[model samples]
Target: MMYPPIHLPIVKVTVLEDRALVERHAEVVLSPGAQLVRVEGLSPLAVDRSLQAQLTGGSVAQARLHRAWKQKPREGSPEGKTEPRRRVDTLEAEWKRAQVDVQRLQSRVEVVNAAREDVLRAIAEFAGAGEARPESWHEQLEAVRASTTAAEEALRQARQHAERTRQRLVEAQAALAQGEQPEPLLVTTAELQVEHPTGGSVSLRLTYLVPCAVWRPAYRATLASTGGGESVTLECEAVVWQRTEEEWKDVELLLSTARPTLGAAPPRLVEDWLRLRDKSEQEKHTVDVAVREEVIQKTGEGGAHQTEELPGLDDGGEALTLTARHRVTLPSNGAPHRVPLFAFTAPAVSEFVGHPEHSPLVHRVARFDNRGPAVLLAGPVELVRASGYVGRAQLKFTGVGERLALGFGSEDTLRIVRQADVKYDTQRLTGRRTRTHLVKLFLSHTGERPVRVAIEERMPVSEVEAVEVKLLEEQTRPPPTKVSEEGILRFELAAPPRSQQELTLAYAVASSAKVSGL
Candidate 1:
């Protein structure tokens, strides 16, 4: 049966990591009877199982998705192709140009080599000619030597040029070969049978998931000193890309963390069998997890949540909504289009951090608590300071009240010199060995402005009870402000302009038996 064409416009799109879920909504006038509605122009990569439709002014009795390959006529046929044929033609032209270059270079090489050979023959003749013109022989030999040297240099250059041209030709040939491949055409159509109560306009929503679409988070962090506190402005953006063969024009775009490929139902538990096999008959089986496809049901849950104020609607536990302020037009060109999602400002703590033992350069860092109502998705961040663009850093998934540290490259204003001393002693009575490490950092602030600084160091924590560790607090200067259970030490201090400060850390490790880790 022929279905009436219902051109649905894409209204919203939720971009995931590797796929996209598109929602199309349109109003159609229907009669008070069963009507066949056909929605076309969908992504060929759309998942058949994920197709869903809803009729508001009508009831959808039946729905089915159909996909077919629509072959385009080859070049030089009555029906012609556009993009694919043009691409192949462009590549062919490039290949022909490269071939011409190769031929030209080859000709030049032959000419250069012939000229070099002629020069060498002339030099050989001059050397063999005896007493014909003894006085003129010296001048002729010098002239021949000059000509031979020039010809050899010219031949070497020409051969080098010829080799480079040959490489270019090979690359062009490969590109042309790839472009010559036949292109496949995909046509997707969704057929729906709807029953309407009246003959008015009826609204319908069609949703489907398609592959080859992805979005990644990116941020721009600007920090400037404001009075005693530092003001940090974080601009959150999304880098969206797709190759779904369907362009999204003037649609509401959303970046989500949904994984629909992983199904919702929990995996059924399988019985584990244990058997003892003979050594000679024993075999090993390798299980591959790389190719395993996981379909996550209810993947819309816990997607990108809004920061600061909570979203009115929750997908499940979290409702991270990064909706574009205005409608955006994104093409299916497989290129990344950056869209600014939102921006927020918060107070932060700016400090100069130094880990002289590990790296000699001191870095300026800003630590701030995520007080915004939205959760920050993990993405790349570009740090900007008052002095301009500092550098780029990666931002991890952070929830509310979580702290994030943004490193702004290196701080050349602060200089640190690290000195470490090791002492080994043997106990005479207990016969146990002991090792002590004394590390000192001499920090000098060379800049004209005073700044806050924090220094970090680490001590090896013994996992076994046999090994004992002790911290010498008396020998340590500017005592550690925080010490993690993992033996990380942090010290916060202030550096005056053109002044110097020193940080000393001392620790001792003792073990009765020789320890493999220290």
Candidate 2:
């Protein structure tokens, strides 16, 4: 989206040719923060409405104007005094130009917010049971996206207002510095009234730009070995927002750590939900009066009060509802900013646009390891379907285009291959601090000699956290191997022997963090 340039008129109104108006003794108060460099007046800045609205959502609308004002020297002014007026003239023009700059500067907050939302959605949606989806969170996540958007809009306005005030002051200052009092400056109150085409402009608020810093140490675990082992250094990086740098610079706590929540706070998990049993209210109790010859007594000490049914109980034979919530926090001034609770809602439907939605290519790829030689993955699944599971093509990778369909290697498929292997590259995630996947490899044999095979991956980093493996699908048994001995989940099926009959290896990883650079 493009923002129209701000074009405020220099608005030179000729003085009433009366000598009295030009007479001295007029008190001139110069506006502050004016500069020199531009003349002929600078243009005002503009913003793209639709784009800003989309970025900030429906919550806050940003209204900004150019910050600088311009003034020309009067004809027949004193000699040698022209030096400062010349300077002021140049600055007035610059002020006009700076006015145009407001949009560019303010737009960044919107861009960052939009990016943050997208990233959050991606993380939740792609978080796979194993690995494959691009980001864990689904884009359809319903959230109170208001606060984040507001913060961004407020920041933009703060910047624009500050700059505008500075510009006006600069013009007034120039007149004073030049040894002449400033006449009553004419400011168009109409322009002072900020107009939002959407008509939803919120009252602007003051904002401060603070920097955030983030860092992760470079270290690796020492493996028990006879020789001196090596280590891989985890690189460090950080991003700066207003106050973000100050807050996150020393973040050492692991966000992964959490205490168990009980009662209402915790959502229903799979295990606890299973132990439920039903008690039927179908049977009713009756009271019988005992008659002792002539006189009868209503015995049985009263059948007690009839039990009232519980309110809001539905007996449609429907299953209990399952809802879970998760919150996402970003780096703030020394504390993580927790977003409001978000539900683990089912796939969403848009009546305005029919049908349920589909995720990106990451979901299209799936793997069925223990089954047959080839498990056919159907087509038309969005990336959401194959997100985490890998192994799209036997040898190829998942390229740029959206992943529509792919298949997994079944147990039968493994048996058929004379030689098979799985391998892929891994790196720390960039931009946000979230879970990241790492790489580890292992191998073993039980029969005679060692085995030689091709261990590999499906695609490149174009699709983060995806793995693809192609091997002899049908196998009677795997080469004997224990995952415990292997440092991390990884394996290499060799090409030939020095190896044995069968073996199995497991591979997995966690979130890689991305951060801005200092």
Candidate 3:
């Protein structure tokens, strides 16, 4: 036996990076024995292979996705009329009536004008023929003058009515053109076959995946200083965009970073072969060297730099699933809607960071550990403090227990000035060239409270045997507190209020004559 299609309401939705999984539930009464059931009102973008159905009191024998073109009622159709359709119909009727009124009033004005012209012509003819006495001619002319005035008044009123009717017609036309559009004719539904020995009322759940739905991670960080201590509050959220043609109202929402499009099989491996060749006479006599900027690679939790062949969801790291804290309602429009996921507060260490070589302004930095349950994905963060919203920053992928730092806004009371001096020399006997650089940074504080600043500087690193680089420690004043192998120099300084401090750094880069560029 065949049964009518049942309308299922969406109860839950799990949105991923590129798609969404929708779950719907409904209860219906059915007769005994096997019967074919159909569920209607699904998105056309739903995947065929992802359809799944479950029956509580019965068993589902077979389920499949079905697509068909169902025509919708047009405007003014006898079947039915939507609200927007009704509005359009009413406006159209009004416009027609207004057009008729304008034409009628215009005809009246033309008739009145013609009658006045005829009366004036008759009066002029009678006076020219000298057919009446002076008193009679005067009386006739006076009567004609009064009749002409009345005709002109009638014409004016007719023109005014016509103009007002025309304005209403124009307004009606504009509103009709700007009315809301109706839904498309294409529809998707799911068909299922079920069997039950004694069926009465049963609850069913239908789940499927749909495309054109995506979500991305976003964050809001607020830094505040309380009487007890300073803390940073991080709120995690998801920005979802979907056009599934089905509204999710008061449904449980889940945001996941899993990429279902990725395959499980490992990539095919290939063999690597190396070839060597002897150098020519010129290559043996001289060595070539060039200076180029190095690209920095980020290390993962394993403390090793890794690269991916294709970009995955959430910075190409592990997958994470987060549930919304409260129920959400999202429309079918393809617009971004932010949904709150979770939030956490942690103790923060606030400081001022300066990079004089790059910018003269010092920025306030806050360092905190990720004490939340899930890893923080890389996304844009909105920065807020006690003074309200300051600016925005980008947060990188941070794992649990990992420390992360964010720069809020620039410090207005602190100022920095940088200067550099360079000197070059060549030794004729050794055929060697040397370049010396002297860098100076001047810091000033205008605030009443003292503040500590961390200054960062970079030095060149030699990658070839013909070039060498070293920091001239003996000539440099107040050496850097920490120096990494990657040629990063860090200095920590404490500045008193209303005071100025100067720092100097000197470095040398020596290269042999065989080197091409320095």
Local accuracy of candidate 2 as per-residue lDDT tens digits, 1-518? 22223222211111111100000111112122221111111112111121111111122234222344335345575565566677666666766666655655567556666767776665656564454543323333323255456666666776676587677658667665767644342221111222233432223221111112222111111111123332111111111122222112222222111111112356557754557566444312222222122221211111111113322212122212111123212333544232211111111111110001121111111221111111111111211111233232211111112121122222111221122344334454442222222222232233254333333222111123322222222331342232222121122345233332243323322222321110
- Candidates in order, TM-scores: namely 0.67, 0.16, 0.81
The lDDT, on a scale of 0 to 1, for candidate 1 is: 0.76
Local distance difference test scores for all models: 0.76, 0.28, 0.83
Model 2, position 233: C-alpha lDDT score:
15
Comparing 1 and 2 on TM-score, the stronger one: 1
What TM-score, to 2 decimals, does candidate 2 have? 0.16
Candidate 3 ranges beyond 4 A from true positions = 74-148, 156-184, 264-272, 281-289, 299-312, 463-466, 512-517
In model 2, which regions exceed 4 Å deviation?
1-88, 91-227, 235-240, 243-492, 496-518
Give the Å error, residue 201, model 3: 3.2
Best by lDDT: 3
Clashes of each: 18, 101, 0
Candidate 1, residue 455: CA error in Å?
Answer: 1.4
Put the candidates in lDDT order, highest first: 3, 1, 2
lDDT of 1 by residue, 1-518 (tens): 34567689999999876788899998877777787888999887888888899998678888788888877546785356455555555566665666665566666656666665675676678678742555565575566567656665665666666566666656666665787666677788998888877757878999999898877778999999888878889888888889999999999998776555545586799999999866442222211111122322321111233333232222244536678768899998999899988888889887788888778888987888776657777667899998999889867667766677788789888888999999999888866778899998998989999888888888877655657889999999978999977677999989999998878999998876334333
Who wins the TM-score comparison? 3
Compute the lDDT of residue 41 as modeled in candidate 2. Answer: 19
lDDT tens digits by residue: candidate 3, 1-518: 98888899999999987899999997888889999998999988899999999988789999998888766656665556555556556666765666676566567556666766776677679779986466765676676677667666755666676566667656655665676445458788899999877888889899999998988889999999977878999999999999998899999999988788877997789998999999897788687777777755552221223336454345446778889999999999999999998899999988899999889999998888898888887778999999999999877777788888888899999989999999999999988999999999999999999989999888898878788999999977788999988888998999999999999999999988877656
| Candidate 3 TM-score over all chains jointly | 0.81
